[model samples]
Target: MNETLIRWLEEREIADVRSRNLELAKAFAMVVKSTDQVFDLGCGTMSNFRYLDPLLSMNQNWIGVDHDPGMLRRSEPLVPRTRVQLREMNLATGVRTLPQGPGCAFTASAFLDLVSKEWIDQFAAHCKDSPILIAMSTAGQPEWSPIHELDEPIRLRIKSHQNSDHGFGPSLGADAACYLVDQLRHYGCRVIVRETNWILDSRDGTLLSMMIDGIERRVQSVQDPVDAQVWADRRRLELLKAELRLTVRHLDLLSIP
Candidate 1:
């Protein structure tokens, strides 16, 4: 499949399985008035908006920021009832440029892991009074059912790769949500953290396969290509046999003033 198509499919799959913290969301909804401005960072194909729009006040004004024009374009049609202004701005260098105020809230999905500690600090400082509900940040390494020997090695390599610069200086990777919580609390904002793990089985074959392929792509350059291929092949076979299960831990964070 084309990489872009794969991303869209993966985003859809994630939306279906995402475990949002409803209590926190409700609180955030209460904090944000119908007239408040909402900012969705790294909005991608608007999965965050599709999930959050119904929870927020109707006719709320929104700004969806992303680095990719293609993603922004695709996101526009996803929420017909909502009023969203899409901007193709890279979050790395542009986060500080976003205006924050009393009647505003910030949101992002599957985005915190890609940013650096400095970036988070800057963002947290700027949006100190604004309610923030960031979702789906990787919490730790994934677990595979019927363990394989190569799992540990591949996981380590993938973790290392994840921490590498992804446009934002060194990425915080699995530590992002934790660090953000600390940062928000430092700024006197009440923070809530919740686990939203993705539990994939045979029923999620396509997502599982794509995840395996994604892992292989990340680890192959650092480890032996043959080993990466072998591991991926075995996982695919297990998927076909209905013996594969995967658990990827993630965190959902909410910050309230």
Candidate 2:
């Protein structure tokens, strides 16, 4: 969530660039159906604008919110200042600053994995009174990876790797993915969920590298030097291995109610 982790996301997710983009596109397509307008939460670097650009070009209104001013500043040039409105907000803190009324929906890609259930429940409550849709939530956890066949050590290691990320939000928000499905339905959204699988073997090193580097940086901030070193060495080995098949199972929450 820090700039340091953001840098890691940028660096290591190179290989997953296409796949991740595709997933976002699929989510956007399902949500808005027609791109009249959208509200993007945690609009980091506003990079998501370009990914969903096909929708943007329809002259749809875009309102992006993020806590990082640096990301908002970087995203300003992508659209006419009028068409795109970027604000500073933290959804976990609250979305009272989010624009009111309906016909527009909320969206987030790979974002559910970063906030707590308290945030999700509060966000759902915000939309309960309107025809607002919580367009997309891509949670890449509780997945079935091809590496299921690998020895237990690596698998356990990968699980341990995920341990830190659990604190990020909903342990990838898989349960929230389910909870949102129900909540959105109650909000009158015609809700459904789609599971997406992305395979990461040795051949796809970009995201692997990013995950490793990001974890390393996070570990460095702690006081447990010995524990950090051990984690660092294991992740380094995984990073070098070209054939690590990590399957990403992500959920697409559809809200049409």
> Which candidate ranks first by TM-score, i.e. highest?
1
Give candidate 1 misplaced runs (Cα > 4 Å): 1-18, 223-226
Mind giving the per-residue lDDT tens digits that candidate 1 earns over 141-222?
9899989999998888888877999999999999999999999999889898888888889988777887888888778676
Q: List the residue pairs that clash in candidate 2.
A: 12-206, 12-210, 170-173, 188-257, 189-257, 190-257, 201-244, 202-242, 202-243, 202-244
Residue pairs in collision within model 1: none
| Cα RMSD, each candidate | 2.0, 4.8
Candidate 1 Cα deviation (angstroms), residue 221: 2.2
lDDT of 2 by residue, 153-250 (tens): 33344434443344334443445577766666777766656654555666666666665555455445544422344544555575575535555665
Error of 2 at 13 (Å): 6.4
Candidate 1, after superposition: displacement of residue 57 in Å?
Answer: 1.8
Evaluate residue 132 in candidate 2 and report its C-alpha lDDT on the 0 to 100 scale: 36
TM-score of each: 0.93, 0.71
